[model samples]
Target: MCGIAGILRVHPLGSEVPPPDVAIPESWLDVLDESIKHRGPDGQGRFRDRATRPDGSVVDVAFVHRRLAIIDLACGQQPMVSERGPYPEKPRNGRVAVVFNGCIYNHRELRKELQSAGHKFVTDHSDTEVLIHGWREWGLEIHRHLDGMYAFSIWDHASAGIYSAVDLVGEKPLYTFSDWPRHTLCAFASTIPALARFQRAFGITPRADTHPMGFSDLLAYGFLSDDGSLGYTPIELVRRVSPRSPIGIFATRGSVRPEPCNPDPARLPAFSVRNSESPEAINAGNVEDILNRAVESRLRSDVPTGCFLSGGIDSSLMSILAKKLIGELQTFCVRMPRLEYDESPIAGLVAKHIGSVHQTLDCHGDPSGDVIQLIRQLGLPFGDSSLLPTHWVSRAARDAIGVAISGDGGDELFGGYERYRAAQLLQRFASFLRMVPSMTRYRRREKSRMTRIGRLVQAAKEGGYPALLMIFPPSELRQLASFPGRKPWEDDPRGDSVSQAMRFDILNYLPGDLLTKVDTASMAVALEVRAPFLATEIVRRSMMTPVSALMPHGERKGLLKAVARKYLPDEIVDRPKMGFSIPIGEWFRTDYGGMKQLLLDTLNSADPFPEDILGIRINRTFIARMVEDHMDRRRDHSQRLYMLLVLAIWSDWLRGLSGTIRN
Candidate 1:
């Protein structure tokens, strides 16, 4: 894991302007480099290339890399350049340089292939070197061959162009800021904070206004999605490099736009299930083999590694496999004092069963402390409450190991969430519900506890499905926000209601919420977390497997349980799914009254809804009612109120940062 930032300048044709002495000021580079120091504290490297276009205009590119020496600690210094061919040490015309973040699990396999193809490597062993050689050998096709979580940029001096790609699963984040009007700069970074600092240092004011629709999307969905796509960060000026999309930019003698290097679907892995095969054929052995390979690949870290055991099936299975791979594995678990929120005892049981070294840290302290820090690190509003526990767990794990494997994508892959079962049940009754007349007229009066039938009826009446999971329902969001409601997923392709919900969760919720929570929390402490469940092969298998196998007879994660039966006790395999969650509702009522006060103060503040902050009027009465209901135990408005609190905290943080920038 590392931090990478780069700036590329594009010069238009017919402009006989002299090339600037320093396209990127050293001060700005220093600011960008220092801002993300937490991401990579081991070492730093910088690369610069200046090339003149055919029309006598010059384009400059600069890359800064912060390294966290996980693999090949000595030889993995980045901003790695390709010197195999006719590239000069300081190529006056062009050069090939790479700045990368995240691990390439298949680098060893790729290295052997490249070496066989006569690509000599100078470094004894470094994935960074593999990328440099791979780029030289395969060019943009390199991304297709990679089987890991990554976001990388490769600058080719010969073409005066830069090609960038994010991993297929978006496990690693990449943000880009393009200043096209000035035609002077295009910048990319691993975190938004680095970009914000770069903008401040370089005096490059963002031209775009706050995206109002994005704010509405955030308020409604607890995330910002533009035109149904869920990759948008809160900042309008910054756009994410969409997952699985390779983009290229060339500085031609004339005007130019970014070129999309769309991967050929044929070249990418496809998910398919052999319908003729019996469930017995997709047995424990086969599932175990896939999981073993996935775990084995992520175990390639050069640093001490551990597994985050949540006592859940997903994490327990991962722990069992990891213990097999690495004898005497270290396992970390967070123990909440609240019985409802704690899973440490179960985690202890799994750890004892596996006979691995286990450590459980109590989740203490005000969660708001972690929330504020998390929001600061995330540089955006993320309403996932699990972040509180995830942060504490990561921090605890980091004390023992630099790398930890998590079972993050298991729920999405194996239909572990209750929402999947609910969706399946809803689908089963959809026909019957369709036959009932006046079903739409049965309005749900209770906001907090809507029954399954009510939800089904409401969804049918709405002409669209509700989010399989939501912070706030659309109706409540409408009451809260000044803007009109819009169904972002209205045009999404229809399928099996359960499958549709699963796909939605995989594409949006998994990446936007779960992965973001893990990445930000783990990375905040410089702990590299790899999710074996999210491995390409495992993901493919899960996607291709018939939903029946995954959720047989209304059993959530049925296939996973079947696989777990071989390695775990029946009690462990058959245990009900208990999510890693905090008692936020309880906290709001008793333990953390200050949190409620903070929310009320932020909402009621004179400048609470600043034009640039939310860009809409917040219904104070509605918000007050939510607080009152939660505090008085009339309703469990924890999720909705938590979302609002996160937004308020994030808005206030951004305002403070802005004020500091002005000062």
Candidate 2:
């Protein structure tokens, strides 16, 4: 984990190597770097360099790196550069430098492959060095060859340009602020707060619609969509260069020209893709090897690293492997007071079997008082109930370890989600009944008597499908006048509600919210959390497997179970996956009077959205009742009320951003 920043001037911004005049604002760097200090703590680097053109033109670049010392602890440093290559005699002069966050699990294999191809490596030093040369050897197409979560930038002096890319899943965040006019460009630690200092230093009213405002957009879709508006801050400026898309920043006369190196993902050499249905014939024996390699790659850091054990197959399997690979591993588990919710015993069993030092933190208190503090700490409004627990575990982990491995991506990759199994069952039913006559007829009918009757029959056949199966129903959503975009469940193409919801969650909720929650919360304390299951190689391989293979007989994560049983006990294997759930509903109802009153009062100030559209008064009542019921142990309205509370919080956050950006 590190901090990276660079500035490319279309024309001359400064001259001389390490251009002093073009130095990135110290105040701005302080703000951004400090915000992301959780990502790196051992050391930090700020490099500002420039080239002088024959016509006295200048192109300046500033690269900021905060090091967390993984891999070659003694020598690995950034911004790392490649040694002389076959064609580029002076590779240093070749001008390619990279400041990267996240690990490249397959770097060793890639290194060997590059070595076989005649690319020389001098550093027995860092995984980052491998990245520098890998980009040089493979160009923009190198992304597909790599596995693991990452966001990195490579400045190529050889091409007089800068290229950057994020992981296919957007796992590792990359945000940029580019103003071609001033030849000013900066990439920072995390979201808005890191850039807050820049806003203050430059007096540039930070773009709210992009930064913090992006939080509300997240509320709409449960995460940031592939093509939705960025966030509230100008920080949303880093448009994805696309996974395989290579961007070239050229210093032209009056403007910096950035052209896409449009590389086809399909054509990449090291590419491997898998789906839920079944593993591709081509990717057989690939998933296990790739996953192991991903885990090993993450182990390359210089600092001590551990794993978050949950006794579930995913984390259990990861713990076993981590114990085997990293000597004297530390495993941290979170235990809730609810007996059903606790996994400490299972986690402890695994730790003992694997000979790892284990610590379990009890989550037995209230976070209602911390809500405001968290909102402010995050510099945005986010609704994940898991965030607080994640915060707890992260703080605990930071005390004992610098890096902790998580099994977060297992469900998304291996058909581990129960919802996906439900989708599979529904899809099968739909497939089996495809020949029905009235169902086909219903497709052509609209609102006539026959149509209404036929549609009713169709709905019955489809199991009472909603327009969208969101946490918040669209009927309720219609009331929030400021809600952006279409209905969350209004898919571009219709399918099973379960599958649609799953896809939606993977695309938005997973990266935009879940990963963000873990990344920010953990990094806030400088704890590096690596998700080995998220290795793109494994994800692609898993994607290729028949979805049925992932969830045979509608079993959640059947593949993971099979894998887990190899090392985990039968008792542990059969245990229900409680997931990272919290008691937010109970808190909101019984203990959070201030929050309830504050939300209702805040919402009442906004009038454009009438009660009819939002069912505001009724929804509030529903929320209060839901919380009350949950507190009374009457029912589990937890998920529903939590979503409402999130919406309320986000609504307030969005309202606050209106004047800051061109909403």
Candidate 3:
């Protein structure tokens, strides 16, 4: 819902102190502010100042914020300063300034508590102020007390440092460039390109030396992990503030970034799914109540709000609850040309049942062009094909409402992916398959699904469980990648295969791929999309519930369907899971050959990757073979080829990063 950027320079504690540059340049802030303007088109604000640490180190800071004005429109202008306490009379010094992105759904509840405890109210309702007060009340623990999807930075006037955090489930994102080794300095923002731009201001030349693990994450999976394996990012000097681990700088800034409590980015923090046999029975009614509250909270926007009614159990149920709360709601669906990939007809039924304003827009476009556009616009190499429809829907809905309730996070949390069922099958027969030797010889082209499953079973047996979710199996990547990457799944959850896979999705895929897809697609159009199922309580319940409840007798999303039956028809609840699925595979083979030509045209260029770079060097020999097999109909390499296209598109975009940053 917003764009935030800041620069912090402070000498590390006990290290020799250096006189920090107190001059905060307005031009640098201007560049940072301009880079992400689409994320917040309503207004902009900036804060530039310097403070002295208790250790006699000087810290210079500059904070810039762009606002979308979703709530408390008049008073929510940010780079907001807390002015409630009696302190230094300079009005600028010793005052906390917050630059934030995403929504705080529980701000009202926290405001009541803060007010009762002697915090004077200024804005009628500003979630930004609650953060200023909450920081005063709880310090770094403020993140724990808040229930929202957010990535925020608080310039701690008292500590002369920056305290930052993302939402617990990684729904929001924060990217950073830290030159802590050279000079205790860090620059952070909502998008990576901003930091890439900031790198020059810090006297560091921008380089695209792909962090090895980052490239690995991209190939092993369809996307890169926002939180890195060793707190590093796609670009070496950059890093992410891992979710739920409140990190900061300076002495009192609580477990600083370099000294994170848990360095692992692939597991949950502050909360993890504990493994137990005959795990405690969960109350279905409690789960339903939590979802009700979650949906209700998402409808708190001051601007006109709507629901993305996909007609699936998640979206339909979310719309039903929201309509009950507000009495009326606007719903929208995108109708695709491909019937197998469209849900508009069913969405119409749900919209009628809820009696809300509904519109179904015909979603047709140049698929290949849209794919290239999103890859560049996202400022990251994300390969989820669903981004096409998500962006189309968000762009259209942005004209009607400021925010939309999305049914994301439902699949990962409730075990809706077929991978979970694959995990079930793996558990029952993995050992037996291990006894039977994997066939060494194969026909040329992509392997059959059974062949793929056999490979996944072998990988799982060999401490490479992440391979089960890979874009390219390591066995193949070993031959294709010029530089190999380290396997990133450590501390695989202790449980049965199904539960383990569910937990893996929650910790890795949910945030890294799915949430990133939605965030990037929606934010590209400046539309706010909130996922109700990702709320803290609801996520906790899903984790605690037994695997049987989530997918009873091999039924994916069994638990959610049970809840949905109460509000949604059986026809709607029991429908096959296909929302925003792109028929790219069919497009490559059938009459929709525009995408096929584009894929060949773009990827078959001389060299798709920068050979000097740390990213995966494409062996044109290997890729051409896959293309030949696919074009000849010997193999269906839709996802694998799609990932290659995204990588190549990003490589092309990265080579063209001049003064102007693309949206």
Candidate 4:
């Protein structure tokens, strides 16, 4: 895994100089590279070159790569260049060059296939090389032949056009800044700040529209925008390369647009649709087969790897399956000091059964200071509190391994969440719930699961399932801060209610919230975490199972449990899903380990946020009241306060970056 950054087709669009020949100075890459060094600590490389197009406009392409050395230790250095792929018919502007992040699990197979096609490789086992050859052979079709988590850009000196793509699941992120004329791609990077720093280097004007999608979107859904982009105030422009965009033209641009290369996800694959006990039995073997291949492919890393065992079905299954395949494996879990949040005992039980090396890293210390640092690492502002523990466990694993296998996709891929069931339950009572919108207006209860579900049902009246997952309701968001409400979420119209909720999470929440948390936390310490359950085949097959079969008799992830029964005892498979979480809510009331104090320090810092950013003018009085209420043990405002704290610190961090850039 690595952090990749580059500037291409940087003409006179944002620069002061009138262009026919102006190009971004290579020094700009240094600033971009420095922002994400933690993503790749093994080594760093830089590639820069200029091509004068026939029209006399000079197109400059520069790529910077930071390597973590997982696949080809000696020769996997990038900004890797190939002499030339054999297929380009046009005048070659330069060699085929690439900067890649994430593993290519099927690189060997691809390499052998390419070699048989008479494509020669220079590196012994560099997965990066396969991409160069694959591009030569497949062109835009390259995404179909490979499987693994990746975000990559190919600077085709051959086509003088750039091709970039994020993996099907978006496990790796590529953000592009495109404000140049004719959709010219100017800057792209693994993070927003890198591209922002590059934009600043050119003296481009900044946007006053910091919360273009409005800050309430961040509060309600944790993101300011939808699938293709984040609500980033474009120093030039910032759009995350999701599976939505297709590869497009060049002005020094690399489109990390994921093509529809994977199996058609438009129609959920059909299942047997038989009576109970039939589809589950039929799919269990298929799931096991596809999942086994996924796990085994991930284990092919050159560096030592371990599993993040939470003792939940996802991790337990992942750990046990990995152990069964490899004979012995190292498994790690974070043991929270808080009993309710701890699952290390159950993890130990699974580890003992699997006969793997088990280690429990204590996650007891105050993260007051650590969290501030962690948020700064996020390319965009993310409100997930679990990122702290995820980072802690990743940091713990980093001491022992380069790659950590995780059970991240199971919940989203299979129907493992109560929310899916809640949506159905709420849908039945939607008419009843809407009648009491007046009561829900004053009912701000969020303590018990019942109350939380109540709030969810209440909120769903305004929007849909997306609203059910909202942190701040529209009225509350408006009352507490001046941030406006986002566009109402329209429910997916295609599938059954349960299936639609699952699909919503797979497409939205998994990528927007969970994966962002995992990618940011893991890569913050330069550790690579792979989720086998999200493999293309597994997603396609799991989505095929009817929600009824997947959750027989009202059990969440029931189909997954049946599969686990093949290897684990009822004790492990039947246990409750103890998510990786922290007691930050309780911590806020007690200011446990100075968390309350730390928040105050940031919030009270003289104008920490731009006067305009904190909801035009932050309702300081309302914020202070909530802090007082929570600290005094009156209400459980932990979730709202934590989200506020993250936004405040991240907003301040962005402000600092902007100040430095302008200066």
> Where's the lowest-lDDT run of ten residues in candidate 4?
253-262
lDDT tens digits by residue: candidate 4, 465-519: 7777777777667776555666655545455678777777777788778888898
Candidate 2 Cα errors over 4 Å, as ranges: 12-24, 52-57, 81-86, 89-93, 115-122, 180-189, 210-217, 228-248, 257-291, 325-328, 352-355, 364-378, 424-469, 482-506, 592-663
User: What are the per-residue Cα lDDT tens digits for candidate 3 across 1-663?
Assistant: 899999876644555544433345666787788888878999999887677766666677889898888999999998998744533433323578899999999999999998887777689899988888887776656776788999999887766778778887788778777775565666788887787777766566566656555666676677655454324455557777778466665533311243353233322422235333423334454667778899999999899999999888888888888988999789999998788778999999989877989999878666777788777766676767888888888888999999999888888777787666666666676667557665423323333665565665655554345666776766667667754645534443456676677767787888888888888888888899999998877776677777676667767888778887877778888888875677777777663737887787777776677665434566788888888887787766777788888877877676656332322
Q: How many Å off is the CA of 171 in candidate 2?
A: 2.4
Q: What is the lDDT of residue 110 in candidate 2?
A: 83
Error of 2 at 83 (Å): 8.5
For model 1, residues 180-249, the per-residue Cα lDDT tens digits are: 5664577888888777667666675432234555665566567544232124567645677766467776
Model 3 TM-score, all chains together: 0.89
What lDDT, from 0 to 1, does candidate 3 have?
Answer: 0.74
Question: How many residue pairs collide in each prediction?
Answer: 2, 39, 0, 4
Report how far residue 41 has shifted in candidate 4, in Å: 0.7
True lDDT of residue 525, candidate 4: 86
Give the alpha-carbon lDDT of every model: 0.73, 0.59, 0.74, 0.73
Please list the residue runs of candidate 4 whose C-alpha ends up more than 4 Å from where it truly belongs after superposition. Answer: 10-22, 87-94, 179-185, 205-214, 229-236, 252-282, 364-366, 437-447, 612-615, 660-663
- Which number leads on lDDT? 3
